[model samples]
Target: MAEMLYQRDVYGKALVELGKKNKDIVVFDADLSGSTRTSFFAKEFPERFFNFGVAEQNMMAAATGLASCGKTVFVSTFAIFAAGRAWDQVRNSVAYSGYNVKIVATHAGISVGPDGASHQALEDIALMQAIPKMNIIVPCDGPQTREAVIACIDIKGAFYIRLGRPKVPTVENKGKFEFGKAQVITKGDDVTIIACGIMVNEALAAAENLAKNGIKVRVINVHTIRPLDNDTILKAACETRGIVICEEHTVIGGLASSVQEVVAENNPVKVLCLGIKNRFGQSGSPSELLKEYNLTSFDIEEAVKKVIS
Candidate 1:
């Protein structure tokens, strides 16, 4: 088994690494520094971190203010608060004029487990995507989370990076992470399985299983959803018989919608989306939640077969 690492575990250390190099890099947390792992950066640069207790809107607004001062600011909190509570502020303040504020929200999707529906941020990506120019990146595991954090140092304008609460198994990914490029893990012509975040690992497992059963499957890891990597995704759609999009988010307005829009506009292929199907999350263990939501590797395998059929 691959060594499991919490996706947010390396986040603090990565922020600290950036803090060491950049004096103008500041961070804002809405009383979730510990959970978001921004505490490491706070401990490293005490003067550069600020905590606004339970005021995500204020925290986001202040983060934009710092960005206006030509500082690269990062705002951290639960995804529900960052994308739900501070949405108006995030849209009008941060994304309006393309301010350099990175909103890295932790505990996204049903993987949040006992945090339940109230705290789960299944709609975060959809909300962030509503604002034009808000970059979205959902790193699948710890290693990619580190890469995403470090890459945000130079990424201009507003960004929405989604991270989960529990430890995630590192999936097979080759080469350095390019901001807008999708990593094609395995190449096949029968079908393409494109996924982001924790679902990437499940997609890989499904692909491997399908390969064993003599069904060729292509796996594409789309860490950056905003930029969408149309080139790579379109290429896969053109080459493959069908497409299966997997996300730990809602099927309506997240990865599934984005891919469908792109493919429909360009090539119009048979696509099946395996994700949370228009239902709020409920409390359970991470594994149990994944199984209940039908987001496991077995689900992806079934979705792939359906798309091909």
Candidate 2:
């Protein structure tokens, strides 16, 4: 695997590249330009960047207004504020109006170490998934995050792209990313592992370990949470006979819930959802938190075993 890179930094650089190509692109940040990495674009296009002094709701409303005036607006902030604080504006002004506003929130999930439960956004995915006409993308690595940003810009609608704060290893699958398509990284007949965001890497690691134990596993990256690739998931379920979903967020309304909904409706199979089970995040290092919450590769391997058994 390549050296780890911060997904937020990749997003920031991607925005600068997109800004140069599309002059109509505008950026807004809620006093977290540096942390969110929007400062890279702010430096390049000062005229098109707006810093809304910690007012996430106002910033989202303004982004919707800018989109109304033919501008492709991209808003950045912490996931908690962007999805929790400004949820009303995002649903009403952005999704309801079908505005071309991209909400690229950083520091998502329990990875925002040292911030405690309040700052970490364990329910952002659940909150955003409930909104109609809102697209969601949770990229796993730096390269995928960059591609996700470009894809969101090219697509016309309201988008919520969840990004992480910690640097993660680059994904080995160097394939083109299509919105609403799940990439199958590995193929197997015993079980299937579906994951999004940082959990994709964990799933891959689990598959490798499972291979040593003579248990074949298929690993899929469900980068796009909403508008889920039901066809791919159904194929995996039919072929593998069982499924295990791993995610950094809560199991309540995240990738696990989405996958279960599809599996229950079409192909009923043994499904194991590996994620936080009705709990809140706590202060710790990213690695420590992941282990504490049973989000590591070992946890995924165990989940796969449980489903297959």
Best candidate, lDDT-wise?
2
RMSD (Cα, Å) of model 2 = 0.8
Q: What would the per-residue lDDT of candidate 1 be over residues 101-219, giving only the tens digit for each residue?
A: 99999999998999789988889999999898999999989999999988877878999999999998887554679899999999899999999999998998999999998899989
lDDT of each: 0.91, 0.93
- For model 2, residues 69-125, the per-residue Cα lDDT tens digits are 999999999999999999999999989998899999999999898988999999999
lDDT against true structure, model 1: 0.91
TM-scores across all candidates? 0.98, 0.99
Clash count per candidate: 0, 0
Residue pairs in clash, model 1 = none
